[model samples]
Structure formats: structure tokens, C-alpha cells
Target chain A: MTVKELIDSGKFEVVNVGAATDTKITDVFCCDLLSIAMSRGIEGAAWVTVMGNINTLAVLSLTDMSCIVLAEGTNLDQAAKAKAIEQKITVLRTDEPEFKAGLYIHGKLG
Target chain B: MSDTITLKYDVSTDDFTRAGEASSDVKRKLKNMNVNPEAVRKVAIAMYEGEINMVIHANGGVITVTIDPDCITMILADKGPGIPDIAKAMQAGYSTAPDNVRDLGFGAGMGLPNMKKYSDDMKIETELGVGTTVTMKVFLAA
Candidate 1:
């Protein structure tokens, strides 16, 4: 599934979406630690986490993850959002916990 | 024909917000160079962990990446209190980072091990209260 579909499903709120929503997502990976996300993160995966730091953006840029879905009411600061835009990472927001978001993504994609 | 390419970056002191900038830049450069995807991923992870270690343990330092036809070598050097026991520090889940660093989504004690796991070769040269230099290489020829 594409990032567009996840957003259009009305389950998430777009925080800072890149110009193209057609990014093909492979799976959903959830991790709060940037290192775990870096080492185990898969390319084209939608990362669901409470991490809302610039390092998260850096991981998103390096892993080339499809999008970042902030869960558990995580706060995304202005600097983080601005960097996400500059880095071209699609950012989304959700009130649900990370596990719920992960389940939704898993079910939706597969 | 392949040529040697090198890039250097300076890591600052305790700037978690901008910690991975250098790694991200190197990853981009590797992609642009059409490096093998696996090699690129390995290099990215190893370098990123090294960079984070610099900020967390050391006061921050410098990273120099040298890419050649056969390998991508990352050299991370920091001038902070060095590791006293390499064996203990290398153990997974062993961390000396404070609680605050863990709260920032790091200090999981997986940094050094993850760097070693991803890279084909790794060496640690350190002196207590002096500094540390971690040299890691990812094979690009394979």
C-alpha cells in the first residue's frame, strides 16, 4: 500500500506530507530507539513511534522509510517538522498507541 | 572505473537533535554514487551508531568516510573518557549512558555491537581519559 492510502483511510492525520503521497510502503516497523530503527528498520516501511526528534528524521532519511507515523500522542516539534519537509519524509499523526497503529498498518497492507 | 572518495564531518558536543546529520549526508552520497544497496545500508548503520556514540560518550569528535572500489571505511575519533573495558562495552545491553540519553531513544547498549554487526570489519583504538577511535569497514566489492 501507499502512504496516500494510509492517510486517506482516515485513520491518521497528516503532519507534514511530502509532495508525492505515492510512496509504496513495504511494512510497518515500530521502535522508539533510533538505533534499533536504524539497524532493523526496513526500507519502504512506515515507522510508528513516539520518537519525535531530528534524529528520527535522520533515521527516516537514512532508512528511506516510506513515512513516519507518530503515535501515542507524541509531540512533533516545529524544528522536527521543518526537517521532515526538507528531508522529504511524509509525517503523520495518530492518537492511538504504537501497537494499534502497527496492527492497522499490518492489516491494511497485507 | 572507480576512484577513491573521502568525506569528513565534525560532531559536536551533546547535540542530540543534530546527531545523525553526518550519517544522513553520507548515506545520500552513497546512494548518489550508485553503491550497492546492502553496502550502503551497512555503511549507514555503522556510521550512524558510531556518530551517536561520539555524542553520548565522548564530547563529540570527527568522522571521516573513505570510499573506494573495494570498501567503505568509516573512522570515528573522539576525545572523551575512553572505554575502560572493551569487552564489557561490546556486550549487548551494556550501556554507560545516563537515563536522559535513553529517554531520547538511544543508549540501548546496542550501538557498538550494531556497528560491528553491520560492518564487515571493525577495530577500536582507545585510551582512558584520552580518546577513542573506531574504525569500521563495509565491503563494497562483494
Candidate 2:
């Protein structure tokens, strides 16, 4: 699904629409550890994690992930939110646990 | 773009939130220079891990990136307590970062391992209570 479709699905709350609103999301991967996420993250996947810090955005930008889904009710701090907007990273939020978020996206991708 | 490009950054511990700025800047520069996407990713990840290490473990440090036609060399030097065991430090899942750092989504013990994994060549020099310097290279060759 494209990012616009995902946003329109209403499954997640929008934090930022990101630079590429129509980029096709290839897959969904869940990991809280930034390093592991960086190494294993798929280029166009949506990352589900509880890491809501500036470094998290940095990892997203570096890894070229299409978007970040803040699961388990996590929210990026002020600095990270600003960074996300500045870097044009799509940021979404879901109150569900990370596993649930990942599964939802997985099912959608299928 | 033929001339070798060298970039230096001073990592500071005064603000933990800005840890990856250096890496992000380098990534942008490499992308502008039209470095291979794979090579740019490698350099970004490896250097980012090193930069975070400097912030969390080493108080702060200096990172010098030299981009030649064939390779991108990153030298991370810090004046902090040195690694006591290189072997253990290199092992995955062994970390010395405190709980506070872990809460920030770091300290998984993957920093050094990730750096080594991404870079084409890696080297480390450390002295107990003195400092540590890690040099990593990512080749731009296809």
C-alpha cells in the first residue's frame, strides 16, 4: 500500500505526512533497538517501534525507511517531532502494542 | 567531485538528543555527491553507530571523515575511559551503557558490532582511562 492509502486507512494517527506521501510501502518491520533496526530495516518498510527520540528519526532517515509507527502509545518527544518534520520523515502513531501494529500492517501489506 | 572531501565534526555530551547529527550531515553530503546508495547506507549506519558510541560511552569525541574516490574513511577519536576488553566489546549483545542510555533506545551492545558489520575495514586503539579511537572505512567502488 502507498503511504497515502495507509494514512487514509485510519488505522493510525498522523504525526507528519512526510516528504513522499505516495511512496509505496514494501513491508513492515518491528524493532525497538535502533542499531538492529538500522542494520535490518528494509528500505521502504514502515518501522514499528517505541523509540520516540531524535535518534530514532535519524535512524529512519539513514536507513531510508518510508515511515515510523510509534506503537505502544509512544510519542516522539518535542525535539524528535521537530526533527521528523525537518527531515521529512513520515511519522504515525498507534495506541496498540508494537506486535499488534506490526501484525496490522503485515495483514494490510498482504 | 573528483577532489577528496574531508569533513570533521565535534560530538558533544552536553546534549544527548543531537547524537546523530554528524552522521546525518555526512549522509546528506554523500547523497549529494552521488555516492552509491548502498555505500552511503553503509557509511551512514557505521558512522552513526560510532557517533552514538562517542556520546554514550566516551563523553564526546571527534569524527573525521575522508572521502576518496575509492573509499570513505571515518576516524572517531574520544578522550574517555577506554575499552577494557576489545574481544568482549566486539561481541554482539555485550554493552557497557547505563540504564538511562538504554531507555533512550541505545546500549544494546550492537554499536561496535554494527560498525564492524557495515564498514569494509575497521580498527580500534584504546588506552585505559585515557581514550579510544576507532577507524572505519567504506569503499565506494562498485
Candidate 3:
């Protein structure tokens, strides 16, 4: 599904400015453990995480994640968002918990 | 073909924020060197796990990465209290990291296992009163 469709789904909150309207998400990986995510997450998968640290963006870059959706009302720190923007990575925020966000994204992208 | 490249990094103890910098830099360098994506990913994950382990368990350590045409080798050596039991340390959920480290999203006890899972070969050398050195290799993909 396209990032625009995800935004319009009304299931997420856009708390950052890095969302790209035309970006596509092929799969979803929901995890807070950075190592597990790096090992198990497919390249280009949408990352659903509750972490808000700057290192999270660094991990995303290594994994080559397509987009990131922060769950449980967690928002990206300003510096992190800026670095992500510099890297052209899309960032999304949502009030849904990590599991629910994973389910919702799976349902849409499946 | 004498095209081996070596990179070294100093991992600081108890520094959660800078844990993965070395691994990330290596990943970028490998990508630029036209290494296979799968091999790059494996090396990145394995080395990153080791780096985190160094910070969490040992105070800090030295990571030396050697890249050649046939394989990539990572040597992580730390001066922290050595592992009492290599078998138990390799378990997926047996961690010696304190609760505070777990709060940072690590201490999951998957570090050593993940390193072994991703690398083609792994060796552990430790002394109870001294330190530990973990050597992992990922063969270049054919």
C-alpha cells in the first residue's frame, strides 16, 4: 500500500514530516529489539516500533527499512526525525499499540 | 588478489546510545565495496550484536573487521569479567546484563546466538578472570 493510503486509513497519526506520499511498503516488522529487527526484518519492510531513540534511525538505515511507524503514541525525537529526513526515510506515528499497528499494516499491505 | 581491508573500532562500556556505530559504518563501507546484500546484512547484524554485547557485558572492547574477497572476519575482544559458561552464555535468553540494560531494549540473551546464526564460523575464547574474544566469519556469497 502507498504511504498516502496509510495516512488516509485513519488508523495512524502523522506526528512527523518525513512521510512520502508515494512510498510503498511491502511487508511489516514489529519489534523493539534492534538486533532482532535487523536480523529478521526484510529489506524494504515497514518497521513498527515503540522506540524513540536516535539509534533507532541508525538501525533503520542499516536494515534499509522502507518506512517506520511509531506505535503507542510514541513520537520521534526532533533530532532523530531530522536525521531520518536527511536519509529520505519515511516516518509515521500512531496511537495504536505496536501489535495493533502491525495487524493494521499487515491487513492493508497483505 | 591482495585486496584485504581492515577496520578497527573502540566500543565504550555502558554507552547505550553509541553501541551500533561501528557496525553501521562497516555496513556502509561494505555496500560501497559492492558486497552482496545478504552477506552485508549478516555481517551487520552479527557484528552489531557483538558490539552491543561488549558494551552490556564487558566495560568496552576493540572490534577489528577484516574484509577480503573470500570472507569477512570480525574479532571482538573485551576486558570485562569473562563468561563463566560458554554453553549457558550461548542460550537465547540467558543474559548477565542488568535490568537497566534491558530497559534500553537489549539484554535479550540473543547476542551470541545471533552472531553464530549469521556467521559461517564462530569461535569463543574466554578466561574467567580475564576477558573474552569472539571471532566470527561470514563467507562471501557465491
Candidate 4:
């Protein structure tokens, strides 16, 4: 599904409608550690994690991630949120637990 | 793109906000050069891990990416406390980064391993209290 569809679906909260909202998301990956996510995230995947930082934005660029979903009620600080906007990487958020968020994204992807 | 193209960037310490700028630029340049997407991904991921290491561990460092038709070479050099045991540090879950860095979602002890994992070749030269230098290469297959 495309990121726009995911955002419009309203399963996840909108943190920022980043620059790449039109990009297609082929899969979903869940991880908090930046390095692991970088190593394991699939191309065009929607990254789900509670880690909100600038490095996360960087990782999104390095990988072909379609978007980032901050789970477990986690949120991005101003600087990180600003960078996410600048990078145009779609970022979503959720107060639901991380597992629940991942499940929802997985269901949507299927 | 038969000729060599070299790019240099100074990675600042504790500036996590801008840590991956150099790697991002390299990725963009490689893509523009029409380098293989897989090769670009490898180079981008490897160099990004190295860049984060520089910010988290070293006071700062220099990243030099040299691109040619056949390969991309990355050199990350830093003047921070070097790794005491390369073998041990290379372990998948080993990390010397402090708690704060861990909170930033790094320091999982995966940087060096991830760098080695994505690149075609990697080498490390380090000395305690002096510094560390990591060299990685990703070959572009014709």
C-alpha cells in the first residue's frame, strides 16, 4: 500500500506527513535500535519503532524505507521532527503498544 | 564515470542530528552516477554505520568516499579513544557506547559488524587513546 493510504486509514497517528508520503510501502519492519533497523529493514518498508531521533531520519534515507511509525506512545522531539520533515520521510505515531502497532501495519500490508 | 570522484566530510561529535549527512550525500551522488542500486545500498548502509560510530565514540572524524566505475571506497578516521580489542568489539552484541548513546537507539554493538556485513571488504586500524580508522569498500559489478 502507499503511505497516503496508510495515513488515510487512520490506524496510526500522524506525526508528520513527510515528503515521501506518496512512496509505496512493500513491507513492515519493527525495531528500536537504529543499526539493526538499518541492517534488517526491507526496501520500501514502513519502519515501526519507538526511537525518535535524527539518526532515525538518517537511517530512513540510507534504506529505502517508505515511512517511519513511532509506536508505544513514543514521540519525536522538535529537532527530530523537523529533520523528518526536511528529509520528506513519512513519519507516523501511535499510543498503542509496539506489538499492536506492528500487527496493525502487518495486517494492512497483507 | 571512469574517472575517480572523491568526497570528504567532517563528522561532528555529539551532533547526532547531522551524523548521516555525509553518507546521504554519498548515496545521492552514487545514485546520480547510475551506480547499481544494490551497491549504493551497501555503500550507504556501511558508511552510515561508520558515521554513527564517529559521532557516538570519537570526538569527531573525517569520512572520505572515493568513487570509481568499479568500486566505492570509504575511509572513516577519528582521533578518539580507540577500540581496545578489535576482536571483542566486533562481537555482534558488544558495545562500548555510553547509556545516553544507547538511548539514541545506537550502541547495540552492531556498527562495525553492520559495516563489515554490507561492504565487500573492511579493515580497521586503531590504537588506544590515539584513534581509529576504518576502511570499507563496495565494488560495483558490471
After TM-score superposition, the amount by which residue B38's alpha carbon in candidate 2 deviates from its true location, in angstroms, is: 1.3
Q: Between 1 and 3, whose TM-score is larger?
A: 1
lDDT tens digits, residues B1-142, model 3? Answer: 2499999999997886677889999999999999999899999999989998898889999999999899999999999899999999899888887887776667778889999999999999999879999999999965
Worst 10 residues of 4 chain A by lDDT: A81-90
* Model 2 stretches astray by more than 4 angstroms: none
Error of 1 at B84 (Å): 0.8
What lDDT tens digits, residue by residue, belong to model 4 across residues B1-142?
8899999999997898888899999999988988988998999999999998998889889999999888899999999999999999889999988999998999889998999999999999999999999999999887
| Candidate 2 TM-score over all chains jointly | 0.96
For model 1, the docking class works out as: high
Model 1 ranges off by over 4 Å: none
Q: How big is the positional error of residue B129 in model 2, measured in Å on the Cα after superposition?
A: 1.9
Largest lDDT belongs to which candidate? 2
Q: Model 4, range A20-100, lDDT digits (tens) per residue?
A: 677888988889888998888788988888988888888887888888899888888899988877776788998987788
Q: Model 1 chain A: which ten-residue window has the lowest total lDDT?
A: A12-21
TM-score of chain B of each: 0.97, 0.97, 0.97, 0.97
**Interface RMSD of predicted model 1:** 1.0
lDDT score, candidate 2 = 0.92
Model 4 lDDT, residue B64, Cα? 91
> Which residue pairs overlap in candidate 2's backbone?
none
Question: In candidate 3, how many Å is residue B61 off?
Answer: 1.2
Candidate 1 lDDT, A1-110, residue by residue in tens: 89988888988888887755798889999999888899999899999999998888888878878889999988678788888878677889889999999999999997
Write candidate 2's Cα lDDT for A1-110 as tens digits: 98888899999999988889888889998999998998999999999999999988888888888899999899999999998888888899999999999899888886
Question: For candidate 3, lDDT tens digit of each residue in A1-110?
Answer: 87677877877776554645576877889999866776787777788998877667777777877778999888877777776777666678888888888988999886
